[model samples]
Target: MITAIRRMFSSTIGKFLALAFVVLVGVAFALSDVTGNSTFGGIGGANVAKVGSEEIGLGELRDRVRLAYNQARQDQPTLTMAAFVESGGLDRVLDQLIEGMAFEQLATDMGLGVSKRLIDGRIADIPAFAGVSGSFDQTRFQSFLRENGLTEAQLRRDLRQQLLLEQLAGPIASMPRLATGMAQPYAALLLEQRRGQAAFIPASPFAPATDPGDAALQTHLSQNRGKFTIPERRVIQYALFDAASAPVPAVTDAEIARVYKDNASQFAASETRRFAQVIAPDQAAANALAAKVRGGTALAAAAQAAGLAPSMSGELTLSSYAATTSDAAAKTAFAAKRGDVIGPFQTGLGWVVARVEDITARPARSLADATPEIRAELAKNKANEAIVDYYNTIQDAVNSGASIEEIAADRKLALATTPPLLASGRAPGQPGYSLSPELAPLVSQAFQGAAEGEGQLATLVENEKFAIYAVKNIIAAAPPPFAQIRPDLLADWRLAQGQKIARDKARAIAKAVEGGQSLGAAVAAAGPNIGSVQTIGGRRGELGQDGQPVPPEVALLFSMAQNSVKTLEIPGNRGWLVIALADVQRPDPKSIEPARVAAIAQPLAPAFGNELVEQLAAEAKRRIGVTINKKLVDQLRQELTGNAPVAE
Candidate 1:
């Protein structure tokens, strides 16, 4: 549940914008193509390529790498188990670093800027900033920024730049006619898959054969370049410090029980239900139909006359149900019970009437069910949060005029004995957790400072809990043995083969169909069980037999509409499907007529990301200059030990 909520706001657009934020400044910014120059050989010299005249300071490079690492880890959840492994995530961080430098340069040259108000607005809208009750919590928001090594001013500056970059790219990527023309191709594709009958054979019945020819593999590679390459992974040896580092306190059951009673509202209780429904073509039509049923019309008989099927009811819970409906009529229908007939209420499309067969509210979630969370939290409070103390001790020592060594001695925390680790966390000069959120600032300050083996005081931060850190080491990423990736190469090869077959067949069928071949004739000619052509509309989910509605593949089938034929190659674990289209339907704004079936979907995806992208862009554009510490980069490269280049 915790992971889900976080992922909920991370839409594709938000990710794209995040990528843009990194690259916006570098894309058109200064170029460090020191083809034959010597701007880089100063003390400990730059281990990284300079971005124009600015040093791609090691400190900035690492920080950027960390950010990219975090984001990519979240994006590719399937690549790891819970957390990113060194071998898989570091390259992603490096790539992002390179892109950031590139875009920063670009933004700089373009003279882009973002305003404070925009950044503020964006911050205000983030769910992370929301209080427990879903309202804006300035304290929480500020706390998060502080913990993440950011100040409102800095974020605003960065966001401003990000905004400008997005604006610059906006016009170019807008939804032009060419993009919308996707509908034509989409429509014909669906028309090709008309509702038909065929048997579905399970892969369990077949023993697939192996390919013997190198030509087969070569052919596969020739057609599927996308599948054969590595994702350019990096192996950062990061040291983490947070909840995992802070020992979980032993909060008593009594305390947890007391807290639960004190906050009973925190415990959720609801009933799950199964509902069956019958909808009319439109609300008015549904209402009229309902009147007949209410006027002593038999449900089955009336359904027959109205060209509708008798609606059935089933089980659903509060979590699975929403009052707002795809069709206004259906939403209005929700108000009625199975046995009770109700008048149709007006909906966005038209009027609706419904008879709910039954409604049952059963027991839902309880405190006992969620006690582990409560206990962990109470434990933190009871322990006075050692994580917080870890930071406070450092801050107090810094304020009391103590050097990093003294502070370390007082807490029995070893003064960092080695140099800072490489920014990528792939490898490190010192042994300990890397700029792990707990020590992010300390690491930043350490690498940016002039002295080596010296500690630096940093602002307070919060990874899992409020904290601060000291750093004395840096490790850089290193290239891995090609032998380690042999298995990956083999898998890539097989995927390429499947894609090649699908692509080749799909194109061939599309061409033949376009060359005046009738669909029936094509079906007869093809050896495989022919898939039927379906004329699907923008809206889907019209209940099939037994209330089974259209699947997403059905929607993808109708996403385009045109006379010219096209094909969709669906790859599956068992086999691939090549679907060819024959007809299409264009969007008719004035003709959003009845029968434009729409499926009930989750809320038109949470718009949080839409708002996030705009805000992040605005922030990135605000801060125009940063002096990256190149000396740190060299130290980092030497520490980490790989020749992998950082983003320029």
Candidate 2:
């Protein structure tokens, strides 16, 4: 009971909204998340909703809904748009869109301004723009913007709204403290239990006596086509090339000599010195310490006498040592001869005194001595330049309307063709087949449409490897022939017919109970196929104890009014359940253990905070004034499912 409530109330609105934004920008490359042509064939573009003076366009709403669906498909691969919409996915997207629009307007009305520097910091923090070194990379950032079809201004506007939302709602939803008295009632509610009587109406016993005609079965199959429909698959022909394939440029000796000459300072004679140093709390103390060292008191002993320890500065060059300490400190330490005491100049650590211990001098290297190092550097630079030139040549070939096969032939590159693959990069009906990592992008682009003859160029592993690909064939998603699936279709038709009969019977039983007939009598009247009435009683929170979700019929008992009966369909069309709530038990607030109450209260605090933020959003909406065009929203949904043409 405690576990369930804690999980339910732990998250704040701030984290929730932040996660929503992350989904939008993080998967910028998943442009094909919404499959099929993006062209809105006929429907005209118009505002779906208006929040304050800002209008929410149909295109924006469509894009957001597609994004939400894509995120959901990560968990449920076969989830359909119809099912997603039925499950309130569209409404959730609409609500989030309306809330964002309201908040942005509210922030503007309040004169809140987000600085460019703050927005830059946020953009830099996004992992999508991070490079191999895990820092912001300008090239990667720009590439993402181009691929996602977003302008810098649009991105900044989104980030600004997000920042404004955080400023407005973050404080209200910050970690809160819930009073023990307030939490006591909630904790006591966990102890409350419900008792009910449940009767199962097995659908199999109610199955049709004979198989339906072909016409009827076909109608059922057509209505439920998504169940039998295969996903679209495509075959791609492609050629790949990597940095290894690029020609290596010859490095002349003159180039190596030039590099060696340019870095003369690096090969010059130099010395690395090590020092023993002590830091004092102040300049006067340091001066006294240095005086002691100069008077034949060893630096370590003098520092120890003053209750400080002497530390060693590792071997460092003049410039390197200056980085660690101050410039003046490094200069003074190096200027002193070996075994000489140097004084009392200010450093970052404190007022310091130091003694030089050792100095190792390195002789200048001749051209022959530096040849190996300089040669390696020049070769690496030449190789990189050659690779860049190679890539540019391939890109230019693609831009000049060369086919994948033609380009491969011209460049002497090897070509490979892929087996038919789904958008998910898996071969349809071939369970054991594994997709090559390099071919995944080829498959994705093929389905999106690689132009005829010319094909498409895609980077397989960023700058290191690339592929030019074109779609060879495409198999669109559709139901298999009716004859091929007749047996399964017949079984489905029978079960569906059985479910309809079971539903009618369950409803009659529920009606009988409402008409003052005893639940057992109602069950008996429904005939022997009905399961015997059984008493069911338990705490509501214990319904999901076996790792599976609570049965809907059982869960409904907790929410139903006492002495009321309800009928619910069993999952998977197995049967129906007639449930009657017989009794309700409420525990006293004083009965809960204080420790448990505290545990429950801790999570409940977030709920209170979330509510405050929700209220803030509601207040924003009220101030801003929102208007929705229901007709356009309905048309947009139709367009999404291809039932209606989309407007430009």
Task: Evaluate model 2: give its lDDT.
Answer: 0.75
Q: Per-residue lDDT tens digits of candidate 2, residues 1-648? A: 011111212354843356334545643423322122233445444667788877766666777676565445444545556666667767666777688878877878888878999999998898767643356867667655664556677677777888888777777787578999999998877777999999999888877878778999899987887777765566778888877889997878888788878889989999999989898999989989999999999898999999999999888899998887778778887888999888787777888788899999999999999889888888887777676677667766665667888889988888887677767777867789897887665564455332344466666786577777777776655777889989988887788888888999999999999999999999999877888998887996566877988767778888899999999898666889999998999888988889989988998898888988888888989999999889877876776655665445
Off by over 4 Å in 2: 1-24, 27-43, 67-71, 115-156, 175-182, 189-206, 235-237, 251-410, 415-420, 430-433, 441-463, 470-476, 501-567, 577-598, 642-648
- Cα lDDT listed for each candidate: 0.44, 0.75
Residue-wise C-alpha lDDT for candidate 1, range 486-525, written one tens digit per residue: 4544455555455555455445555666678765555456
In angstroms, the error of model 1 at 1 is 17
Candidate 1 wrong stretches, greater than 4 Å: 1-69, 78-156, 159-391, 395-492, 528-556, 571-576, 580-648
Residue 412 error, candidate 2, Å = 4.0
Question: Candidates' TM-scores?
Answer: 0.36, 0.72
